[model samples]
Target: MDSFVYSVNATVPIFLVMILGGVIKKLNIIDDNFVNKANKYVFIVALPAMLFKDIAQSNVKKDFDISFVLFCMIVTTICFVAIWLLSELFMKDDTMKGSFIQGSFRSSAAILGLAFVQNMYSNTGMAPLMIVAAVPLYNIYSVIVLTFKAKKRNEDGSLIEVSNAENIKKACINIIKNPIIIAIFFGLWFSVLNIKFPVIIDKTITSVASTATPIALIVIGAGFEGRKAIKKIKPTIIGSVIKLILQAGIFLPIAIWMGFRNQELVSILIMLASPSTVSCYIMAKSMNNDEVLASSIIVLTTLFSSVTLTVWIFVLRMGGFI
Candidate 1:
């Protein structure tokens, strides 16, 4: 009961923040063009700043777990492959493949995973660093899917040519040049080198990085595309189940296998069950892979995660797992 209340309190503000995003959109305070501009700000500018600063500032000596990180990687990869194969086997057509498969594997750490952790622990910021790893992992997977794969028809499973290799190569190049990637690069570089950035430079980066969460939430809110989501709720729910259930199914057993402590298990479960990344949808849209379906999955999963997430939280709490 208490956890539910806490979850609700944490979730409600994000909804409000999203609404505030819409309000900002309407008021013209953020500029109508800001919608296009925002992708650059969060991905290119603010997010990188945050990543570098967080990784740079974090104490390198705190309860590190290479085993856990490796576990997450293997489990996530397994889930990704299982879903890609399963979703392909069960559902056909480019639209459906792109819609369902991406949602199955792509986890929204910034909004859902990071939010849950921050709610559980105020200002500790360790979770954000774990997210540095998640970024490259998420991108590499998404791009590979975008790059080489051709979608098959639902009726006959025939490959339909959509994108060219030149475009695909360009897309890969662009993804590699991502500001967040750059930030993560420098952040890790500093961490490995054990060098402290000057205080003023660190402060500047921190201030810019702080904009990421709010601006991201706002853009997320504005980009909800709920009417489209309503049209596709059934399929969207199916995608959400893949993300929430399938990932949890894989991760939970593995966590238990590793003799994970309760909080550790709960933390991984929450991350596994997070909504599909808006960034995935954005990439799919840019890559011309069922953008509407991707958007529907994003909005619906984000909505469903609010409820399913609360249920998971309670389950973990009751079982003394969280």
Candidate 2:
């Protein structure tokens, strides 16, 4: 119980940041145009720098928990499939279907994954390896989803075209161009060859990289608007169920199979089950797919994570992960 209170208290700062974003949007103090600038600041500089710093400074996960990695792959595969099937009922329009499905299956790695890991583990033993292991998985998953949902033109001259293979191709190209994935590749190469960062370079990188979450969180806050979510209620509800329920349900058993238990496994599992990334709303919108629905789902799922995160933490502490 005390743990729950403390954990929830830690989450308050994140919510406050989100509220600040909402307030900014409401006040129109931060023009919509600036949001793009903020994106550039966070994505191109702060985020990539942070990844480089973390990778350079940290000891690599020499032997990734293959089981954990496997779980991540399998569960995400299942999520994409599940969302595709679900889209048939509620989102037959190919463009909307692609974005909606990807949104359902994807997650906000920055906010939920990195921030939550930093908070839960603090100076714990497992965090470094978890971060490294999670990096490739998250990066790959994100690119794949985004590519699949990218704009396509149908034969009938409709603005949206949907093809599983097309999305896969886009994802492959995206992964190649992605800075994070590139960083991960470098990190992995350095790890395999046993490289270490020089003290000065490490310090410099760490200083720049450290800005990622704090600044990104603020930007997320600065961009959020409740108005964007009005018509997206249905997809939001549908996505919440898939994310908080189905994804978690499958992941728990996989954690047990991986031989992790208690708090550690709980942390990983809850993260796996977290709501899809808030960034997806923005990305889907940028690609001109069901932006309203995507944004709504992000808002709703983020709200529900308050409940799901607490429950998962309790269960993990109780040793239910195994």
For candidate 1, lDDT tens digit of each residue in 88-142?
Answer: 6776554667556777688876545555676676643445445655656766677
In candidate 1, position 78 carries an lDDT of 77
Candidate 1 runs further than 4 Å off: 23-32, 60-62, 111-115, 118-129, 148-175, 285-291
lDDT of 2 at 104: 71
Cα misplacement distance, residue 196 of candidate 2 (Å): 3.5
Candidate with top lDDT is 1
TM-score of 2: 0.80
Give the lowest summed-lDDT range of ten residues in model 2.
Answer: 123-132
Number of backbone collisions per candidate, in order?
A: 0, 6
Per-prediction TM-score to the true structure, in the order listed: 0.81, 0.80
Residue pairs with backbone atoms closer than 3 Å in model 1 (clashes): none
